[model samples]
Target: MSGMVTSAHAPRRDETERADGSPVTIGALVPLSRPGWAEAGRHLLAGLELAVGEVNDAGGIGGRPLELVVRDTAADPQRAAAAVDELAGLGVAALAGEYHSVVARAAAARADALGLPFLCSSAVIDALTERPTHRVARIAPAQSHGWRTYADFLLGAGHRRIAVAAQPSVYWASGTRILRDHLAARGASIAELDMTEQPATAVCDALAEQGATALLLLVGHPEPAVSIVRSVRQDPRLADVVIGAPAGQPEFAEWAGALGASGAGIPFLRYLPERLGPLGARVGTALRERLGQPPSFVAFEGYDTVAVLAAVLRDHGTDRARVAASWPHVAVEGTRGKIRFSRTPGTGVWQWAWPPVQVVDRDPAEPARFRILHTG
Candidate 1:
């Protein structure tokens, strides 16, 4: 039986076979299908469910089984907001998991308005809530913290002429601005290429005209981004130009499977320590097996999400207000490091402050393997 449950109105026993008939539900928001990055959602869910199974095995939250009331956000802000409403109606103690920043923002806003305590698993937008709220705590690093690190990596790598192939979205726009400000302040230039305004081939032409040494992908996956990469890779004019994705789009296996050698050597941001601790190592092994491949950092984020929530639920009952209030009190040892929350300036929600950040890529010589190029 799956550790996570989908039924909105009933509870089913998972592998735990807990004596208590009642189940504690965490409403999960993930992008499970097209338009959404399904690969990321799968990794996130694997970690959440893996931790859930372990929580159950350890006798659960005071003997009641823990389950995830799953909902697919499908990368839509409106859809994610609706899911937040539906999950609240389902009586979940708290909400968890979401990959896309924009989608998570919508869900976070709605969850806030409804007075639901949400533990965001992933999503790095700085302004998650319009006003400071104790109701939401995040497991992911804020966008500024991670993106600035990525900019430093580019600067250290001798990349001065940077260009971004961008789509129209709040998340992408924020990233472009962050890169532009950080790089420009350090004597570098930043240019924007609108993928929506031009075809992939045309984008290549624009990039070549800009004479950029690095191109940041501030766009979505497998569509214009993939097409742009292929075009740039095949273009002789842009052969020396480096490609980067600060959003970590290339961290998934599907990226390698789809692009093969062409996908290699494009650095991207990821949240993981340079080395995993004992707990992280153990969880990594389990997640690797569960995923049938090496687990991405996102998987660890998912696990930490549940671990924190499980701790909160175990110590403080299932009351919604209590769970939300417990964020500041949390000091659980997570797969990455010790997890805690505080009000980060600018992000209105309670944030983890920072997570280990790495700029990594698939080796051109070994497409299946990853190499860390920079750390933040």
Candidate 2:
């Protein structure tokens, strides 16, 4: 259980409660500890906690206080699956929150087996399940959808020859395929530089030789990814090459902290509209307070996850089947935009169809500021 875990019932002074007095519990799976992207997890947890707090304050599910039964996934698939099984056993109405796609897939599979409702918050893998299951739905944009948009951004920027510093993972592989297929259709080609085999300097050597105009960081953060960015930025031979992270690595403060000016001008994917609507503006302000830093897109995804689930739980009640059934019926105003789930083709689960996608980079002039380069 997370430190943020609320008791099953802790109604406010003015709030009402059910006769049973049991809270409506949500299972929250976040990568909070080592080996996981803990910074992203903190932002994600902040959003989830903030939304859960607001839901409780605004009168929880039918007077019963809403609660989160939090679990730390630690970025391990097996750990995530185990957590899902445990959460299902704990009688949570649904599961939510995870930033890593592979871990989310593992949790999704377990949730499907247990017939537990799961509203995945931030993982963007296209195939979240081995097959379609009503029990699992997603709030994030599908990898195919977001990555194709990223490919178009690269092409429109006139990068004919692109190289990716890729690690071994299904998520990275899927992104590579999406970019390759989309870019190839427009007469551009991609080269893969395996991070497992090459050092950062070696990648620069290959980029220099290939004369690639872009190098996408399709690897993990701060280690190989940060090192690669440093090496590429230092190598004058590849000075003109654009560094990109279609996976949205640089959206958090840690990326800028690690690479500073070198991290600037490196474009990454972000899911946000050109401007926030009224609800979004309010939530963003609240989230900034909750997080003590500007919230990332993942934080919005967390808030939206709760917003959608709370609507379902309030309208349809806490029956597991009803919550699962409520995915198609959801139409809640979220922090980003109107969020609803439907069966998107090839997604194998309920999807939001699309969240706004943008190609953004930390401004070269001010690394703390982000500049949107393209939108889709």
Candidate 3:
């Protein structure tokens, strides 16, 4: 019930769900809840399950269909490793989805050791591709990339002095570095602030002292990022400085509110393929019917991850090595856009899923206010 009827094709049943309910299936593992992320984890799982249903309804991969084996990683490296091993023991063709960079790395290593393809939908740290053991494909733009894009936007908007803030994670570090480099290359000056462990007040004070025209925030966590923005908003000199984000957060609007900031003159970058939405929405509907709601970003990623593997399987067959090798060319419509890999691993850039930038020049809630800055 949770699948797509491609406009070009009719809805069909997957071979996996025969009257007897047996078929070639795969497993999807996601970060289960740690002490703090129970709600987010559940949402991600729901999205993945929704994707599985849609794929099955569309007659499943090569007509064989798939069964999803679900596992919870608890967002811990040790636990994630154990869960992947468990899935491997079950002989799943491929695996997808992890939020933590370290946990994703461990999963990728295991997939490679076991000769399985791993598609990372959210992990954007540049180092994930450095693993020699696992074959991996990433759907999100690398951390450095989103930052560079934001820098370009700010420079174009006549902002020369910028302030940068980021969390301590691998993704945030790389993103902040890239923004610095881009600004320097353009002969623009930027004051950098690493919020790795600093209090929000200190960060805001640092940005205020810089007297920058804008803030380029790459803080990994939305809540703290919001806090930083709010603190800055209280400082008259800092409030007018435009804020930019490359990492997509669902609470971006709420964070803006907490900071008394508006998306006006703010820009956010996304790396998902363009046509991914219609398909993703269909999957969400089907998932809601059975699982009560679509999964969170994590679960949708898992579904996309499996879909990519299934596409490769259809094109290449059951050979795991071939599927890994063919990743650079294996393209599929995802929730964000058409997803594919770069021939050069770890480019920190994606060839597909680039959307035109939009300027938040007014209240973010205003309709048609998102004037296109660029188009695919």
Location of the lowest summed lDDT over 10 successive residues in candidate 3: 4-13
lDDT of each: 0.89, 0.88, 0.59
TM-score of 1: 0.96
Q: Per-residue CA lDDT of candidate 1, range 23-112, in tens?
A: 888899989999999999999999999999999988888878888889999999999998888888777888999999989888888998
Candidate 2 error regions (>4 Å)? 1-4, 7-18
Model 3 misses residue 175 by how many Å?
A: 1.1
Clash total of candidate 3: 19
Q: Compute the lDDT of residue 224 as modeled in candidate 3.
A: 74
What is the Å distance of residue 274 in model 2 from its true position? 0.6
Model 2 root-mean-square deviation: 3.3
- Runs of candidate 1 with Cα error greater than 4 angstroms are 11-20
lDDT of 2 at 96: 96
Alpha carbon RMSD to native, model 1: 2.9
RMSD of each: 2.9, 3.3, 6.4
